[model samples]
Target: MEGKDTDQIPLLIPYKLGQIRLSHRIVLAPLTRFRSYNSIPQSHAILYYSQRTTKGGFLIAEAACISRAAQGFKNTPGIWSKEHIDAWKPIVDAVHAKGGIFFCQLWHPGRVSDQSFEPNVGQAPVSSSDKQCSPLVDGGVEFKFLTPRKLNSDEIRPIVDDYRMAARNAIEAGFDGVEIHGAHGYLIDQFLKDQVNDRTDDYGGSLENRCRFALEVVETIANEIGPDKVGIRLSPFSNYMDAGDSNPEALGIYLAKSLNKYGILYCHVVEPRMEVMEERTECVVSLGPMRRAFNGTFIAAGGYEREDGNNAITEGRADLVAYGRLFLANPDLPRRFELDAELNKHNRDTFYSPDPVVGYTDYPFLETII
Candidate 1:
């Protein structure tokens, strides 16, 4: 933003991502707005995603639970049924209308969930192990976590199929692709991170074993759809939701190499724990090795700004950089970055509000603000 010509900006450089030739390198990181009520995407999302669409830009939708049992928090979208697929069709079309490439992020909360968010008659939340998450403390009031039921050897294939089915549902709903939510201590991460995965079965113990479940999901989804239509988000360096690994760098590189076997679209890796999901400082580990190991396009996310993003691309650290909060507040994020325009400060309080227009689509575009 400071030193060079706007035309020379690395973020503005066009790059081919698998099948699509993108107009820019900035991606809209999947932000879970919690605005989809009753587990169904609402009409309001049309304006929300459409406002952010730029010709040939990429946007990953918020985490859509693979099944009813996968719903961790309230009001998140689901893709496990035909009704859900129909609901997403319009929203997907809205982005496509503007020539934007949209990818649905499929996820399962696993142990991060509680029975309270379940559909009729609550069943126990399942994970790789029976260990429960520690209660979250907020203003001295605690929300305790129930002991999650451990998945038996026989039950793993069904959940793997859930991911495969969700990916197919997303494509049926008119999405360009599906990104597996393998990051953020979700179902896949619960198995990848050794801290939570205490299984003595084939899914635990050795690093390769811990990664088996994730690979299965990737392979199933790739086969169900196609490898070019698949991507997986991973954060081996993150300790969020109590899913930290002992050797994160190794974990990161290993997953990157493993993913090459399927030749998925891209690897979206978050910054280390301290920089993840927050405004940041530098992290101890660098993503260079992971980026190098990943044969497909590599997207680096978490706490990146215009200058930082440009630097990452220029330095060949990543093929693309994702912006979460920035994109949330500034729908015309790529244009704003191109012009070095001032960004509207985001209201953190209303970020997760259920109101459709409050902090959701009310953020003005660059033209209106000027």
Candidate 2:
């Protein structure tokens, strides 16, 4: 196949977000590979990440649970212990050795967790309210979610502290920075959305009150690690894992404006495709408004092809574009995009398997395939 002219692709251009400079606008979105065994990153992770690293490329690690109670999936890594920190050090080093920038995504699953996956099996998951939801787990089994116990007013601070310490852990583990996983129906998103957060305390009732928990977590983590080194991911229109908002556009704009106060490194937003699961009058809620509201760098993710991502960046819809499946199948994704090369098809079946290699690091580079 003939290569596309490099001048036509805006994705190959370098960009800077605060102190972090990236060689290209293509970012490797955080993907849950589930290769970590016993909640610790293993040797396979180093190869899995380094293979995708391009010089000065920006890669966000898959969400690392902030605490044991925050864990929701099997084999997902954690950053809450000394061993977890020690384990991540080499993985971070490998990316750095390739001249890449890495960010650890700190996460908490909240009420979206199953009893079988909890530290205390049979323990009910905790959330802002007692609403229960049954979500599909691995192997297509529908796991019945328990009615979560409402977090006591005093209990909220400890969760914030958990995020603060996790930020510290990421820095110690040699990560360039940290991205707070406030999106995708996780703990922070659970609190931000009104459909799930039914409470009369300071953490609920008004929009400002509802945003309190998310703000606190961001503030605490930013203080722990410099605000310039911190970023956040938000899915205002997402109903996945049962997180939906009455007014996503308004919520997104409010968050964008609020986040501007801290001068964070970037704010990552999921594109409209992921929000389609929930019925909406508008097929695609534009990120343009949110982009204009925020002062810092903005990243757009979900359902973006090379041309779409380049258009989004060139049109000023986002400062960067994150790709998930494309990067997963093409270890040399940046070069492939630059050349308009054929992308390897990703096998969905092997996405979360515990195999050390196979689909994980076995994807051949362009040169190897040639």
> For candidate 2, lDDT tens digit of each residue in 164-185?
9999999999999999998977
lDDT of 1 by residue, 1-370 (tens): 2334656889988889987989889999999888999899999999999999999899999999999888877889999999999999999999999999999999998888744555535577889888888765432223456678899979999999999999999999999999999997878999999999998989999999999999999999999999999999998988877898999998999999999999899999997733533446567788999999989999999888999899999999999999988999999999899988999988777777789999999998988978
lDDT of 2: 0.86
The superposed Cα distance between candidate 2 and the true structure at residue 283, in angstroms, equals: 2.0
Residue clash pairs of candidate 1: none
lDDT of 1 at 271: 79
* Candidate 2 deviant stretches above 4 angstroms: 1-7, 137-144, 275-282
- Which candidate tops lDDT? 1
lDDT at residue 310 of model 2 (Cα atoms): 91
